[model samples]
Target chain A: MTSNDKIIEIEVLRYRPEQDEKPFLQSFKVPFTDDQSVLQGVQYIKDYLDGSLSFRWSCRMAICGSCGMMINGVPKLSCKTFLREYYPGKITLEALKHFPIEKDLIIDLSDFINKLESIKPYIIPAAPRTLEQGEYLQTPRQLDRIAQFSSCINCMLCYAACPQYGLKPDYLGPAAITLLHRYNEDNRDAAKAERMQLLNAHEGVWGCTLVGYCSDVCPKDVDPAAAINRNKLNSTMDYFLRFVAPRGGN
Target chain B: MSKRSNEPIVWSLFGAGGVVVAHTMPVLIFVTGIAVPLGLVSADVLAYERLAGLADGWFGKLFLLVIISLPLWQSAHRIFLSLHDFGITGGETFFRVVFYGAALWGTLLPLFLLVGM
Candidate 1:
């Protein structure tokens, strides 16, 4: 909006399924201030330069977890990434890597959604109780166990950064497993045995060779890599214990 | 989707091996290769007669077995997974057999060598 504002080039990867056989890079130059984010730059292109540009973003403050994309080959939330950091150099924007692009900047997240559902991301009560039985109280120490993992907003950035998930799509990738562990760590939850069966599989935590990039790309500081590795110890114990006591577990 | 895998059996071995390699191998290397040669430890501490005597003992044989065998499993698992990371998808069963078979051989060879002494 200022006369002294500088113009920057944003090279966006475009793919219209009905129009193009493959994705291609298209550039747009837009004037912007130093404080503006990459999301604003894309919005400018949509509002002023081209109306057909497609992307998903709901919360501009980074909490809604919808505006994630590949910014210069790294997974990042557009709303949290500043364009001024790359002012002189042009920036490349692509859909999250390792996922099929549905449109220009949107990716097909149906696989991620399905995995999220399979984890049963809810507290299965250790014992059923009526409303009059009162609230399930947890000490701060008990809360600390799963609090860090609960920060995941389902952004799927970890999946984009994971080499295992890229190689094996059925590997039950990071965010879902982190969420799964969050519920399993709850004191009131008795579903650890049931969830352990899913985690004990070949494609579960073992699929992760501990490449550890999932934790690096997490904007929310949710260390899915730690969650997966911790569960590996539990899974290992379960694997041996099953031979001795087939019907016994937490 | 919830079918169990035999990976835990191997992974536990790999994990234990990794711990031994990480925690003990350096100390072992330094003590034998540098400490004795540099006289930080007396040359007589690792004398050939003493080392042979160690190899002849049951406990020392167990220690040598653990030190030699576990690291083999660790290195093999690492290599097996590294190959997969490099996008080598074909002949997976063949690769597993060869790599793990080599590790098993390494383990057994040490056990026999130490016990036979």
Candidate 2:
């Protein structure tokens, strides 16, 4: 073997409902180079070792937002996490926290998906214009309001990082709420009133304790905590101002 | 289907209290606790008669009420949420009643004291 070949133990949490009743750890000795990522290590195991192993990944690049897993109990994208960092030692890979394990490394994202869909993630324009009316122009300042929030890639790493979401699954989570703020801040969007209705609930931004772990774990630097807090301020204003002008003022 | 939460009422108090405490509490602390005792400023600044005179005005009474009461609300809200964060959920209503109810009492008592002055 060449000196460049570095062998490391990769322990993956395996769960197959058909054969195994419970999830258990399975370790593989993976030989990798310094440039190989943790995802590549798992790919090596699948290609050369156990083909039955299951996981989800696409666009080996970090932008796909897939391949998020719990590495040493921290949420990270396997594509971005290098196995060389954990070389000469064993690394454990498990399904992302706060999510149900569908298979080995594949997690059930349906709950997060449902919550994302509930937030009306698409833009609802304040005033509709036909194609003949040309594009809606916006100043840089207008873009700046929502720009930071618009970077969320829906990786759900923030969800795994959020203790509030783990405790209260019904809570409208970080990414979805950040996306809501994105649309609300868009100058072309006029659905702030409708969006405010969703945000004015107990399960909305109020549910967030501002642990800020979500922001810390976000790969895209999307500060969902800030988005939620800002909306908290908005919801507070709406709550009190409802007494003054009950209807469309929001 | 959107549901409205009454958390805004308490949250507003918390926000206002946060602002009041952050902005003015340090100055109050330095002026009353440190400067007054150290004689860094004039003793007449907090003399009994001078304080009484300030309290006699409606605006001064209002200011005192806001300064004293809002911080209480803020602390109560923070404590209440912190309890929830710590996985203590059985006494939710009880804690709310005790914490916020105490703040309410604190607020009322100060108003009564300030107005009587």
Top-TM-score candidate index: 1
- Chain B alone, candidate 1, TM-score of 0.87
Score residue A63 of candidate 2 by CA lDDT: 89
Candidate 2 residue lDDT tens string, A21-58: 99999999988889999999899989889999998899
Provide the TM-score for each candidate, comma-separated. Answer: 0.96, 0.91
Instruction: Tell me how many clashing residue pairs each candidate has.
Output: 0, 1
- Candidate 2: docking tier: medium
- List per-candidate RMSD values in Å: 1.5, 2.4
Question: What are the per-residue Cα lDDT tens digits for candidate 2 across B1-117?
Answer: 378888989988998999999999999999999998999999889888887777888999998899989999999999998887787868789999999999999999998898787
Question: Measured with DockQ on alpha carbons, how good is candidate 1?
Answer: 0.82
